[model samples]
Target: MSDPNGPTVRRRRLGGELRRLREHAGHDQAAAAAHLECSTSKISRLETGQGLAKAMEIRSLLDLYGVTDESERAKILKLHKNAAEVGWWEQAEFEEILPSGLGVYVGLEYDARAVQEWGLGFVSGLLQTEEYARAVFASLPLRPQDEIERLVKVRMQRQKRLTQANGPLELWAVIDEPVLRRPIGGPAVMRAQLKALAESAAQQNITVQVYPANKDVHPGLRGSFSLLEFGPADPRIGYVDSPSGNAFLEKDKQVRALVATFDRLRAGALDPEESATLLNTLAAEEN
Candidate 1:
């Protein structure tokens, strides 16, 4: 079952560990579920990080798998307990979709060695200026002012990970030119956003590219997506957000296809230097 509350990074980690253990023991989903006396679907969901695993359930599975090492078993049990802990977003009461998941996403971003993003609509969250983010939030229909403010604040906080003391997170972003020309929040706000984009592009750790409307072909014409490449310990993952909800892709074949599509889109987009010039020209037009 999908957790309506969303899964935490700890939960994701635990799920990964559980998957490794099951594979090491040569137990398929049906075999593991049978050992735990649960539905195979339940084992599948737990391994995929779509649902939480109870401590006792985890313990039972570990025992059934013949895991006799006390240290390893305790470590796995502790991870399960941590996974069940509440995240900071749960305290805010914001109605944003994936509130709990956002915390995990942010944590992943913080640790990721490199991030590649492509957007067909508005700017990616990490690239948006505070003003742009606030305007975006305000445009949401009938949102409470307090809730909107909270969401904007959360977004801004997430951006600090890209600029703070631990050192910049490597970022490469490709956005449709139409996103720049859409005049979100009117001329003044749009101009500011364009300028912000130019400034961000100047940063050594960030690369911003634009795919003009006149481009003959591009893979990202379909929709927005992001590919996050983590350090050695974690696998690369692809994320796509839509009206229904966010989808995370981790299967090797699917992620490889997404990466290939992004590479093609990049090939068709303006190079970083040219993209910066285009942003500056657009900003000048707003003046």
Candidate 2:
């Protein structure tokens, strides 16, 4: 079985532990930085899982945090060691195409058992066919043909987790109706994409819901977002990408709001069966 605790997740775990330890010791990032003789920004990065900490640094932080339990120290060190490893997405093939924010989001998604995604203007990447993805990328201004192909490959690779043996991602995607009718790559691409979408929806691990366009006002109107849940132990995280910028939301309040919004969106959308029917109807129309 593949280990779900990849480098990214380990980094996050180590950071969370360090943050907790620092808080418990009644010391702030400044104090931790002073103890390690590093800048506060470095401390912040380590605490937020954005940067890896050396073993010595981890030890020093533990000392500063007053963490005395040998077992706990060993655990933290192990996490640090594991966090140093590289994930598949970090490979050369995807290095240039996977933006930093998207890389982090992918890492989180890899560890997550399920994802609830709200698609506003496009089909969720997890549900998009290669041609459709290429068309979508090509539509963006200034995107070269090579970059478009690389991005499409990355998107397709991400879908592998859907069929992973140990644990497949349970995807619940709520898509907007217009996205299905948009004809991104033209009629042929739409037909193939919609047909593929219908087949994917038939899978046991996937659920599709189509939000009708007539419903003018909806909670997801704000933008497209995805909520990734890593089971009961870890808190869910929300991801949002827009024209302005992209962000990963970790606060309970922020995540909860997205959760509620997703619930409302799904509630207003066509159910799984109806959604599949719509996909089929759209595909046939393209014929």
How close to the true structure is residue 63 of candidate 2, measured as C-alpha lDDT?
85
- Candidate 2 lowest-lDDT run of ten: 1-10
lDDT of 2 by residue, 1-287 (tens): 23557677778888999999999999989998899888999988787777898898889888888889999999899889889998777788787777657887877887888899999899999989999999999988887788889888889989998988876889999999988999899999999999999999999999999999999787888899999888566788899999777998999899999999999999999999999999999999999
Off by over 4 Å in 1: 1-10, 23-45, 50-54, 78-103
Residue 286 lDDT (model 2): 99
User: What's the distance in Å from true for residue 285, model 2?
Assistant: 1.2
Clashing pairs in 2: none
lDDT for 37 (candidate 2): 88
lDDT of 1 by residue, 1-287 (tens): 11212235566678888989989998899998888788999887798665787788898889877899999999998778767865445454532533535655665565566789998989888899888898888887887888788888778876776786555677899999999998888899999999999999998889999998997766787789889876455689898877666778899998999999999988889999999999999999998
Q: How far is candidate 1 from the true structure (C-alpha RMSD, Å)?
A: 4.6
TM-score of each: 0.85, 0.94
Model 2, residue 125: distance off in Å is: 0.2
